[model samples]
Target: MSNSNAERETWSTRIGFILAAVGSAVGLGNIWRFPFQVGQEGGAAFIVMYLAFVVLIGFPAMMVEFVVGRSTGLNAVGGIREFAGGAWKYLGGLFVFIGFVILSYYSVVGGWVLRYVFGSATGGYIGTAGPDEAPVAQQYFFDIASGLDALLFHALFMALVVLIVALGIKRGIELGVKIMVPAIIAIFAILAVYASTLSGAGEAYAYYLSPDLGYLIDNWKSIVPAAAGQGFFTLSLGMGVMITYASYLSEDENLGIDGGTIVAFNTGISILTGLIVFPILFSAGVSPGDPGAGAIFVSVAEALGDLQFGRAIGVLFFATVAIAALSSAVSLIEVVVSYAIDEFNVPRVRATAIIGTLIFALGIPVTIDPVMVDLYDIFAAKILLVLGGILLVTAVSWIYSDKALAELSKGIGSFSGIGTVWLWTVRVPVLVVLIISLYLGIDSFIDFLAGPFAEFLA
Candidate 1:
């Protein structure tokens, strides 16, 4: 069969694809969610477990998607069907739908980050710290989140994402990622360094780096799923984002090294976020608020509010978040566009415009209602993501294992150290763990909707 991918967009360079993948993976989840998970899950223990998932599961899962997309050289739905046959093509559609659902709420959250950047720039949150911090940050978040301001910023964020996707691979997605990824890293690195200079910095390091074995033992039930979810979430797996991104990669690029690079950069930035956030929060004598939007918009904002050069720090911090948000949003929106272009033969620009506007409209309710955002977010993160992951691995293992391995092994040194492990990873241990992760994710979400939740960290 002729490779349809030959006719589609290709990254101009290997670094472009790697950076774009990293950008997709390292978003609000890394900056906002990872730190809280570390603190809640006994620091180093959670890190160890999460890394195990990455090494044993996450990386292989990623390779599966890459093999599917690159081998078929098509969008998620088309690629799966082309390779796997039967009703399996619909599995790709499911991922596209999940991506749609994710972007609807994700864009709204990105808008919230946008408002924070603006507020930080103008020093609107400067005096809201100390005793009144929580109320001020909460009030500010709710006001901006529900008000027309959210819609405005949401539109702006969406427009930026659409513009990039419409520009094609070489000129647009790859280019934007090249600039955004480095800027995100440099600014965050500077922020982390500055945070380390704070008086209570040692305390922050202890909280962030020290392992609490007792806490791990006590909270193992809660910690397991959180680590599993974070591993998938931080890697941007199970959402068809990687499938579409990998479709653009050429035949010469080695999937193992490229995937590893993306993971390294994405994981490094997440760890850097912890370094920046904990020190500031500790020195300011503020506990990380409950594990939702409060951690970033409220608790961290309060901590930064009292510091010298706080305004500058806040701007830099939120700026880093804004870039991460946009980068990830770009990939999500592109997932939608790629599906349309491949399956429907729609023009990239027109597809992007239509899908981007619709997602923007869909997000309005989420942006307006705090409850809606929370519910939709929980559903996507826990249910859709986890289930998508299970389905993804199953398809790769049963339907197209040999084909995936063939694609992945191309232009590589030797598969001795890697291929056998990656193959069984999809077939056996990884599949079992993903099944468990899905159960845990669903059980957690059920408890979430039950109100005043028990055991599970919200």
Candidate 2:
């Protein structure tokens, strides 16, 4: 039961590790959150700020997690403790908490996605009648998005996550991501090509790619925070996912190159998703600015239902989401699972089982109520995620600066010069933005607590 580096499982290959890390990074945030944010925040302008934040903030912050994980070769909690010791372990504890809470509601959404996949194949919602006068797809989404069917699907999805993580690093996670990430990219690429041929493709492309500088300049304050949050979440920076995933890596792997590649792939996939989504919405004469769950479940579903061969395409789209969700869920559950296995000397299967069941039980409220999903996200995912990132960056940049640089220097040849730049980036801009984002997130979260969240607590 000793969780030594010698006994611990490492990723089988560099590419396998990259794919798994990319899988962890690319999730509903890319497919579900990104396009909606783009639409809601003025399309190309938001994308512009998003990409800027990715380079300026996300990449360096990611490297901080990479160095922390690979240096300790331990789970999130153990990793921070190994390097910084004492109270710093709370930083890693925050990671475990975020992973646990986020996955609860995340799986609920995953379940809805699975239902959509099945519904698409069965034409369950394609031509169905609405109870009232609402659109069939919209009504169908409302029905399945919460309640009994949602609970069942959520359990089903969480079971898949637990099964994969319980199988250990190589056999389960590496193997799963190798297949899933490539398949996700392939499907999105094909869909983007098909989407380009849609009727309103021209307008969609214009809206998605052509930024109004005036809009960005005029709305930089709001757009900047939204884009920063999106960039941070999409890269999976604040969640300790990168830390957990990087722990499975070998020393010879170039961390800098791998980080860049993962970011590149994740960013590209996110943009490609927007390309596929906007055109479909535009073609169907559906506005893309509906935001959040409505953008994907109702708007996209309605659009797909109206297209030729729409049912088949819907199957592919939701299936991709299901896969993406599962892939990300694997990493999230693993953060907690790995923590248990590494710190408590618990067996992987037992840890996955106990932890997965607890997470599923936690998700029940969100499944039944649905409103808890947003509440859980703002309070658990966004706030804690930013806090974790801030703590990790501070610990790396100040408390363990030299050691962090040494670890980052390993396997990075010409990139060795990056240590100082990375340090300052982590110290200055990354920390500044994360702190600002955390403040804004807390402000909003407190507002929620005072409003609807208070009602939920009651």
Candidate 3:
């Protein structure tokens, strides 16, 4: 709080900001959720819908976050209050809360990735390495996914996220993403090429890329919501990440171009992930199976084990996952840490430590029981994320339309026409799509909540 707005840290370069934003967008949501969701839904049809939603819903929503952040040059709560004062701060607080709720369990999954890295390196999980590896990998995942090992790795992962964030925006976040994002792209690109040479690549590509329009038409009701959720999830929308990252921008930076680039890179990386995962699984005669950690840790891990040099590939693959998870976790934690430092006068180091500890503690239930992870993931992804996206678009489009346009106009230049078009996109298509996603998500919300409530009442 001692530092003026002028003294607050900003990205050292435009590319640095973009990489950090892309890093936030590309995480387990892309690598973990995208492939399984594609498989569990109708494969190519789901993917087609996801891409459409990303263009229609995700991109505009991201622009809204960027507009809010860059205009105010403040954290989510302060940024909203700058435009619409009074109780509107609660909306911003909801964003900060989403960051906490997400990173809590998110880091648990990050922990699992870290353990997989170790397990792959030492042949710990490769004993039954083959096409039949999934059942063994499932048992292996079940064993370490909870209890003391899970707790230890979860703490370890949280520590890494806190360390990077505590280093501050330029040295911590920007620097970390600069290194992590390229490595993610490079590794996945290489993996995609390798996966392409597999015999099943033909079938996998057909399944992943060749849209079944008839299937999509038949399943439009289900596929649309899932696609919208994935679009929001993969792009890091509805989570205050874009808002926090954009806050560090200079006035003249082009939000539209940067937002577009981030979305492009995120969607490309997610598609690359599907390329790597599906081909490998099909080559091994293993289905991607149902969504969740099983799709990656069980199915993909098993497929990797069946290949030549599978262990080495597993290490490299899971290490990339670890990097992606850490990069995204940094943004999530920064959302809260930046809030504390900006609004509460807390030092960066102290805020990170205290907040990181609290998040890790919140993840303890996730370590104690896998059910906690499912409940948290479903609620956050299905309901909270979509709801957040809808509210943000509503705020910028209706509540602060003039202010939002003025901020966007700062560096818009030749893209000035986009400002008006984007406004309507936010008002209609983005809002309507997200509302539908939220409504469809209610069934899942109820299903996930019912299990825990049933257990509690029993």
Candidate 4:
């Protein structure tokens, strides 16, 4: 089919489109990062702020991206240029590049989950460390985080992503999401139920739910940025992944309702993650305050080691996580591939291969060096995401204001009345908040860079 004809074909069903978008949004960010961020950011307050941002900022931005994609029926660069004009085409390119960088590091992390699932199945790391003490588990995680082992797993992960994208939107991407998203939710529900039976589950619930306002006060400088970043990441913003996915959308669907549904599902999974993870940690007598990625792997692995059917539980948990991670990675790769297809007129398969090859090459530093991996993760999550958000806000608000409103108002008859509300109230205020949040996020990241030397010595 011609590209335009293909674009004309909307999702076979609304559920399919919602499932696909939710699959892209609900991933490692929801399961892996959200719990840890909540623990670090004083739990309840951070959760509240995150919800607020999702409603005020993330929801509107999602609508904007959906409008841009469906209205133009083009990938990111083409969508922005067509909707707003030539001046903002660079904004779309920025989104594509940001998506590229994010997927590079994200694939590495997804590879780690793939390895963990294998290890869980093989009973590796079981019985190696006590729940309250995870030194051996931490070392095991570090060993896998570096060298040729890491590279192999990254390649394996990237290959899975490429294969899915090569299958085209309807056959591969949408179908995979339809299956994976439901599976993720089902698995998480089962685990959350299981976690509630742990000895100190009550304490875990308290830790996650109770608001320690003082912690938020003391850590506001750090917590706000963390919350904002997590909010954006959880919703898959600033990456053009949403734009690419939405490009497949037909105008008959309601962007606002779909966008709200996606955000709700994504945020719900994040909360579910906290429910599952914190209970397990607290029950195992592990401190939730331990910073760094190792905190999750070591703590959760140790907890699983002690359970009655720990091996099986570990396998299921990590398998779910790995699937979630891979699903998001595929979405990210699609963004890059879509840009290639749209801008360079490359075939979808060729574009997928080309982008996959570049990611495979760029992933080496992350696989070989622990420090580089951390730096890459930090840069993509903190710096590039905020920059992408700023550019998107500029493009949507100033350049494409009328077009955005018109597109966003396509369906839902009188509900379009709120277009003015979205633009003047939600969009403008959130843009301002994003600006302030971006500055603070950058500053906090710089401080983290500067303090590492002291932390190392200590």
Q: Which stretches of candidate 4 lie over 4 Å from their true place?
A: 1-9, 128-134, 453-458
Stretches of candidate 1 off by over 4 Å are 1-4, 39-45, 128-134, 452-458
lDDT of 3 by residue, 1-458 (tens): 43357868999999999999999999988987788789878889998899999988789899899988988888888887776677776888989888899999999999999999988888666556377545666777887899999999999999999999999998999899999999999999998999899999999998888999999999887787778878887888888888888989999998888999999999999999999999989998888756554456778777777888889889999999999999899999999998898898899999999999999998998897666777787778778889988888888899889998988988878778779999998999889888888998887668656766457446
Quick one: how many clashes does candidate 3 have?
A: 0
Model 3 CA RMSD to the hidden true structure, in angstroms: 2.2
Whole-model lDDT values for every prediction:
0.81, 0.87, 0.86, 0.80
lDDT of 4 by residue, 302-401 (tens): 7777777878988899999988987888788887887777667788888898889898888877786555655665677777777788777777877768
| TM-score to native of every candidate shown | 0.94, 0.95, 0.96, 0.94
Look at candidate 4 and tell me the lDDT of residue 90.
83
What lDDT does model 3 reach? 0.86
Cα displacement (Å) at residue 101, model 2: 1.2
Model 2 lDDT per residue over 1-458, tens place: 43897778888889998999899878888887787788878989998989998998989999999998999899898888888998997888888888888889889989989999999998877775646677888788888988899999999999999899999998999999999999999999999999999999999999999999999998776677677777777887777888888998888888999999999999999999999999999999998887444456788888988899999999999999889989988989998988888888999999999999999999999876656777887676457777888888998998889999999999988879979988998899889988887887777777778986687678
Name the regions of candidate 3 deviating beyond 4 angstroms. 1-3, 129-134, 451-458
After superposition, the stretches of candidate 2 with alpha carbons farther than 4 Å from their true spots are: 128-132, 447-458
* TM-score-better candidate, 2 vs 4: 2
Worst 10 residues of 1 by lDDT: 449-458
RMSD of each: 2.9, 1.9, 2.2, 2.6
